[model samples]
Target: MDEEQLKIMRHSCAHILAAAVTELYPGVKLGVGPVVDQGFYYDVLTPTPVTEEDLVKIEEKMHEIIAKATTFDREEIGLDQAIDFFRERHQDFKVELLKDLKEKGTTKISVEELADVGDRPDTASLYRTGEFVDLCRGPHVQHAGQIGVFKLTKLAGAYWRGRDGNPQMQRIYGVAFETEQQLEEYLVMLEEAKRRDHRKLGKEMGLYTFSELVGAGLPLWTPKGTLLRNILDDFVWQMRREYGYQKVTIPHITKKDLYETSGHWEKFKDDLFRITTREGHEFVMKPMNCPHHTQIFDCEKRSYRDLPQRYAETTMVYRDEQTGELSGLTRVRSITQDDAHVFCRETQVKEEAYKIWDIIERFYAAFGFELEVRLSTHDPANMKPYLGTVEQWDGYVAELKSWLEEKGLPYRMGLGEAAFYGPKLDFMAHDSLGREWQVATIQVDRNMPERFGLHCVNEHSEDERIVMIHAAIMGSIERFLAVLIEHTAGAFPAWLAPVQVRIATVSQDFVPFAEQLGTELVAAGLRAELDDSDEKVGKKIRAAAMAKVPWTIVIGSKEAEGGDFKINVFGQDEDLVVARDQLIATLLEATQRPS
Candidate 1:
């Protein structure tokens, strides 16, 4: 179906949902009901809390409304009349909205804003379904019957009009499909997603934790979580060495003046956490690693050949992301991004971007992540907020888009989504449960160079500003680890597994043998552990399985006598019995990156 038709159907579903809620709870006040990406939601403040069991009654009511097949009649009424209608029904939220609408007259903005800005304070559009009516600018389905296959998926508490301090409303979320089979398929996917939820699995595997006292949005990494992070650090460092990226480190906080000069304070001050030290120096936790890297580039004079300087850092940064928005590890206040900046001459910008994209593709391939690339450009109408000159913005955006097109790369355009200082290419990936994430990004920045006075002499020995390309192969290591956990369902690949091999002793008699085998594996540079805690063999195996150890070696009388081990590969189809030397060689070969 077309976008308009799909929206009409989804909006119709929302109306049915609202009708159901009103019938079940007579005095509920309605908030905004809108169609989102996959479904629709209607916010309501009911007398009693809506639970999962309550949803069954709501669904039944919805089905009955749909069966009645009421035509969605549209009516145009005066602002006062609309307010009176909803006020008589005790929907204070609607009355308040109507009063605001009448008070704040329309302003001329754009075609998109026209609906929101009604020229006539005399009249507003109202959509009526059976006995229920809502103030809406809608083009809904012809009849309620068209909402054929839909399911009320979930519910959550949301603030009215997205204001946290406002009254909280219960939001009922539902998804619609054209056919019953499609609904069934979506339900199955949701079930599978629940099975692989990172928060649930992360806790089960002892990966990470959060404490209410320590505060929200700040995740405390457990010991096993740290091991997972170290594995990623090792892997990325190896890749950086191969790709010729110079490693660097910077402090987590810098003077407020640095952000002021960089213009980040003016543009993104709210997202940054300000810190004051004992010396009375006002500082802010770095929201990004770019400005610090710029300082590194400006530390000394540069030659033309020194252009295209690549500096990489696994840096920790802080953001004041709202507590409500934070999730397991996907969203957090503190993040460690595998960040790098390429300071290159204007002519080398495109090539440098292409090189960064290549590196990202390779890195994602190692972890089995496919990408969707988006070219984010500035909107001319919104140019006042962007830092660089119009000509520079035009040239950089055109060059990046042209290069992507020339290479036959598919990309969607995201208007007005650029960083405050630059245009960027956002690389997104879908986790195993089909939830999309912004994983990596490559940005072309023209403003930062001038801000920091970064310069290199050209062929004629005249100084020129260097263009900076900010790229992160894996955007944030912590967030990426969360995705990785869900993607693999905690079964990490052999190379990344925290404890790659677990040596299980059949009895106390074989405890020494298990320890010796673990020693040998550790010496071979593998993460190996010996299980000799007086637990039964079956119990030890189960515990190792829970840890998601990639391989397990059973050390019994037969294997010890032969100087070999019986190995079982977790999450794999087969087993192999190999001598110590042969096993190490095979593992090393398998773990090495493909050329």
Candidate 2:
């Protein structure tokens, strides 16, 4: 089934679960039941807290309710009547919702009731299954039995309506599927995901960390993680330099007027982190780098010769993300974008886009990802809902579509997925577990130039509009790190690994030799670590492997005496022994960026 239909089915199962919950605990108060990822959950308040062990009993009761083929009765009742009904059942969460509605001018009066007085308000919508009734606006299944296969997954605590100031409620999570086979497959994938969970693996691998005192969503990169990020950033910088991107820098915070001029303040003011100076000047931490790049372009007068002035920066941009939205590196308050903007004449838009597309292909392919293109365009039928006029949007979309087709690249067109300012080509790369991630993006914009009055002198010495192309092969370094960890399962390739080679000695007797060899590797521009711990040889080797180091060099008496290089490569069965010079050459070859 489609996602929406599956949501409906899962939502219906939530009702059965609620019904079974109330059946077992007569006085349990319902908070809210909403459909979640792959399943549904009901926030409930109970005198006795629910634990994981209770899930089986709850599942059994849900099966009983499903067996009865319980029908759901949906009704639109007067606001007062609905409030009174839920009040009698001691559903305080429903009362809070009703009060919120009341404050928003909702009333028990309907159009028919207010025909004479000309005063009407929306009535409350609710659903009933057996003796269990809850407040909801539902598209639930007709009968409880229609929910095919389901499993209660886990339980966690949640606020009444996600407000910290509100009462705590127990959130029960579950998954629903159209078929038992699908359910089984999903469960297996879920287990695999747990094993590949970036948050879990990140900590175990010592890549990054988060501190509550430092606040949520702001990651403190450890030394190892910083190396990995710098490596990725440096590589991208070198790659873009070949594409004529000039490295640039801008301030982290800007006066409110800058964003106001760029239209970001109006659109994302609430999402931005705002600050006020001692002089009462309003400012905001930048949520994106494009607006600042526009200023750089406008700093000097340009001609057709400088039509395509590309600027790139790898810097942190801040956002005030909600606490609930914060995850590992995937979602964070501080985002580092390999952001670049290319200012070109209208005719060069196609060429610039092609260059970026080529970059994306080479970049992701080097990392073992075959990307698919998605052309996100504005909805044709609706012009009022979009950022730009129909003609401008259509041209922007058509250029990307034609460019991809001309290159013989397959792509999918996604309507109503375009950004507010322009249409874009998004590159999606799937991980090893078949989960798709949008890592790279390309956008063609005409609005930003207009907003900033950006123009270049044409052949006739007349001011002409410049098309801005925003391209980033690695959208966000933090997010890419999360994806990379899961994709390679922390065993990064030799070139990208934070610790390229870990030198483990057979004992302290060889510590001097191990350190000397590590120094040589470092001098040759390779990252290597020497382990002089008193641990056994086997333990040291295992330690190096567990850290996912690309190479483990074990130095024993024989190797130390003979000076023969023996290396254990991750994910390889055969041991590698080579001449000292040959090994250094191999290291240099493997660590160099792909051509």
Best by lDDT: 2
lDDT against the true structure, each candidate: 0.83, 0.85
TM-score, every prediction: 0.90, 0.93
lDDT of 2 by residue, 463-552 (tens): 998989898879999999899888888888888888898899888899888888888899999999898988997888788888888888
Pairs that clash in candidate 2: none
Once fitted onto the true fold, the runs of candidate 2 whose alpha carbons sit more than 4 angstroms away are: 25-27, 99-121, 380-385, 408-410
Residue-level lDDT of model 1, residues 1-595, one tens digit each, is 6667877798889988998999999889998888986689999999988998898899999999999999899999988998899899999988877776786643221223343443557667899998989888788887998776989999998877655578998999999888889789889988887787889988988878899998877888898788888778767777767767899899999998998989988777878899889998899999999999999998988888887788999878999876556777888999988899989998888888888888788878887777888989888876766897778788878988898889898899999888879888999887666777788899988888889889998889899888898998788987888888888888888777777888888899988877877787789888788888888887887888888887888888988787766787787666777886688887666555443
Tell me the lDDT of model 1 at 419.
89
TM-score of 2: 0.93
Off by over 4 Å in 1: 75-87, 95-125, 159-168, 276-281, 388-391, 432-435, 593-595
lDDT of 2 at 112: 30
Tally clashes: model 1. 0
